[model samples]
Target chain A: MSDKPKILILDDEEDLLATYKDLLTNLPSKPEIYTTTNGARAVAMLDAEQFSLLITDLHMPEIDGFQVLAIVRRRFPELKILAISSVLEEQYRARAYSLGVDMCWQKPGTENEIKMFFDCIESLLEERPSEGFRGIQNKSLVDLIQLECICRNSTTLKVISGGIEGKIYILDGEIIDAEFGNLTGDIAFKKLISLKKGSFEYLPAVTERERKIFSSTDGLLLDAAQTIDETTAEDKSEVPDASETGDRTALVKPVIAMSKIDGVDFILIGELKSPQPSDSWGVDDSKNLHKWISNTVQLWRSFGDKFLCGELKDIFLYGHHCKVVLKTKENKLLCAGFKATVNNETIPNLMKDVIALWV
Target chain B: MGLTKAKKDQSIKLIITKPGSFTVDANGNILSSTLPLSVPDKFIEIIIHNVLETFLTARASGLIFEEVIIQFIGLKIVAREMRGGALIHLTPLKP
Candidate 1:
């Protein structure tokens, strides 16, 4: 019988995986270690085997580490779990604690801290509690409100109750961006901060480029409208002519046209290159590539109204290059023809995939 | 003789201070001055129209003039040149 305790470590960073493997190998017992880059895969592995300890990074592709914690707590109440995150956002920390995580560790500057975390786990394993902790019950909207009142999380709580959406942005869990449907900006955000919510959903963080594009469109529209009003006032004395108004209208039309499309979004372009003598394009690689493309297309398809007009130029796979073209609805070209050699294909595809997701 | 010589000297000084502006005609030859140069209002209007047209076209094609200034001399006008042959200076209106 193997006397050493088993451990599972899940993180997206490949280098971190190697580092953890090295660390674990040097330990006295040389416990069995399992490493995976994704949370979903880790969950599947957990279901198949028994591990004394589970260490997971918070942010990951597909499912986040927090969600993994939730799933584990529901199915396997006895397992010890540690939450690791690069972001030290209070909301994330609070949520981790609320989910009954045993310990939370921050990454990058805390190598010694991780060693300490393992020591604590070792002690906890020695003394096992007889009765397992019960999982949290599914709450109704009223129950959620009562929970918020008892333990206020200082942030916005956006709730969708009975098919109607409302926001309550809480400061120390006080309500703040509350409105019925699709409200944004300072006023809406302020309103949300003041609500006593039903149940709420946190809005996803937007990229810097997305914010800039939206603000710029708003400014351009305001300027155009101001220009029209001024022109009308100046021409009040003169007899109104249709041709003059038409020219004035033309000046503002371009601003209006550009505003209709969100320029920050990018389209993914895929390219395939002929394999070299040393290159290997086996079945596994081809399958992975196809899966990546299909998943990306499906995501964009879900947001049909936001990005329906965008086009995906045919995949360009040939000699040493492939490229994607992203253009606006106005047919104004944003980025054109990005190519990567066969030897360095991953970067170009990743770039295309990210841009497509952003769009 | 003295009065006539003095008057000729003044006219020469005026011409020197306010160099005549030029533009390309239909045949592409540089026309020395705008037609009816003595009429200040008409001359100024025509010059402004031409300048605005050139400015708009250059701006659309992403070109910019480094300096654009109008200078005026007594009763005669001259415009300095910049990139893309943009005339910069203007002369005072001739009464």
Candidate 2:
């Protein structure tokens, strides 16, 4: 109704409300600041009039910030909300985040914190009218993820649909972890990606949660797509034959080709992100080799970092009895063993040719 | 300090030179090394230990393998388990 942006400040302490009101009123935009000592009164005021932003304190008597956030987010999805707490525990902030509070932080105390708090408010007010990120609506989470992954962004995507909310964390284009209620990692990621309709918001940070999902974004999305297809097929037939044969066969094709080379003892193919081997032949224990590769990859990754030699794309082992070669492709691996009789001078060129073709 | 081949090279040559190598005993101690002084023994220990542990683990799981050659970009490490000890060679080649 007014040209000046309106912001609602809800806190139990009248003094803090006055302080925040005083600080926000001096903003360059000179926004209209509506301050209320009571949470219910703040909600009522918000309902009565349009507010550009909602800054609510988590600790309160009856209508706590969590409850207020839940109600306000559902009723006023478009309103930019920031939840603050002096208690400063992760559980409170995490709960607020799940409730869809736009920006959650521990209550500002230091000068820098105060400045950042005001800066956040000013930006929120500035973006009040713009449609850039009030909410990323209509676009599926997959599209948003692809965009972020391609940019190699480190951020957390929060998706809300049908009142269900989930968070997917991406660090350097890789989907490291995800959260949806009690579910986590790959299960959570699959569940979230399957969400067809949702408003997604992303923050420029990765979660502190332990790395749960190890697959690359492409691998994860591929798996998710396959999983979704399998689920849909289950409804169509009484006995749903959801097998990875088609995909696994494609993965093993190159390995099989290498295995057929002269003097090649066996070739094992495995997804670099997964623990189990994708396919193998002639090797006595493909699973064990995969396990060794997984562990060895971890070690080599560290070595790569220390030496600055870059990521390990392949490994070659030579012994008196045999010559073994391991090559890494996108998200999978190829390990081939050759007889001692094979020409040592020709193996590298031949292996390189096979690797060049494997991709 | 490292032999890195240009990507324009179509083939990877097997004749990469080994710059340094070391031997570690059953106790995981370094028996000998030709690596430069700048190369930390700690690094060599860790690498040998890792290779040895993984080899034993894999062997326990019924996977019998005697030699391991690992290649990374232009860096390579080849190790062979021999009589309760391991001989590890570090090679820096552009292939």
Candidate 3:
């Protein structure tokens, strides 16, 4: 019957429940907090009370967190739910996002961190369209493509309107090449960016092809942005006739491009940390890993001390779920983790770019 | 009788060169494949072309071309230059 908003916190550990309950009570909003150790009891509380937010841990003994999330999502479609756990794998985290969890918080530290966490919960409750890809309404094509590259998304964007269709290929977050009519690469990319109106569909596809054109993703995006800007600045009345217009008048300076890195999970720049058991790879393959590491060092030594060996590179192992790419610059070692789905052609450029950064 | 039976077997699962041999064009398009149809032609063609291109470049750079081998977690791919194209052999090492 209190005027304060109620929050439900569920966890298997009583101490964790106590910690959360204590943290929530001291917030500036002074939220009314309730704790339940079991998921079924939490469901019962959900049925009985009208809570504003639900924060549940994923790994529980009785009626695991995913089930609770499904029940809550189906019944209370508007209620915001957060998935928190200690062992958060990449795939598990991806699954949670797909299931409509507002956010996934790994662990909480100091009081200030807890307070910041509550702030995020409050923001999500306010309901902003911030997560996932949305239909392109008011957004420009250039900005959208740039966003995909920045996120390292592997997607093929199809644009179709007024019987004009084109396909842009993006792998490992870089614009590899594009095809529209008989055009390819920059010519095709320019025409696609010149479109006035079109509905876009992004299909995430696995790609393995030799890149016909070479230009940095940022460079291509910048060219598109500049073209769009130039077109917008031109007066509609002064627009030249189609026959008189020259398409090749504007040329973008091309920079040598790096290789695509589609499925790399993590890029370890130094010595390997004591990998957690939850890792999809690591410590479990220590013997083979040690041999691979020793070979990498020996290969570096073979280059001779006076050779500088700044450009030294090697492929440690190319497994299904794990790939060990090693590059040495000066004394530092750069290791790249690649998923099996990655295009093998990108490995050399990936090594070169990482070495360039380190040097 | 043996020729007729061999022709029927090829229709069911083509084995032009061997069970896992396949060929791609200069542009990496699938020209012919003996592998199962479930494995997309484009996927196989591009992957084979990319892997072989590395060895071909080495040959072009004056390195003696013998053979290149790639061992993935569950599969092993061995490529060797033959005629004007590369002969790719795929073997599943694990389930």
- The sequence of per-residue lDDT tens digits that candidate 2 reaches over residues A1-359 is 23689888889998998899889999999988767666655665565456789999999998888888887886666688998989868888788888878788788999999999899889877873432223565555676888889998889988765457789988888788999988998999999887655466777676576899888788887887787688667656744333633333343356555644667766677887686887765554466678777776767767666655545776666656667677775567777777777876777876876676466
Against the true structure, whose DockQ is highest?
Answer: 2
lDDT for model 1, please: 0.45
Cα lDDT tens digits, model 2, B54-94, are 56765665455577767666677778887767888888766
- Which of candidates 1 and 3 reaches a greater TM-score? 1
Candidate 3 residue-wise lDDT at B89: 71
Better of 2 and 3 by DockQ: 2
* Chain B TM-score in each of the candidates: 0.33, 0.74, 0.62
Q: What is the DockQ of each candidate?
A: 0.01, 0.22, 0.01
Model 3 per-residue lDDT tens digits across residues A167-223 = 788898888888788888888988888765555687766487547658998788788
Error of 2 at A194 (Å): 32
What is the fnat of model 3 with respect to the true interface contacts?
Answer: 0.00
Cα lDDT tens digits for candidate 1, A1-359: 23467678889998998888777755665676767776765765565456777888888877788888877765555567778888868898889878767777776467677687556656645444332112322433334433554575544445543234565443333333334466654444323323222234555322221121222323433443455456457667464554666554333222122211222111222322212111111111323333333432333222222212122232221122233222232122222223333223453454354344324
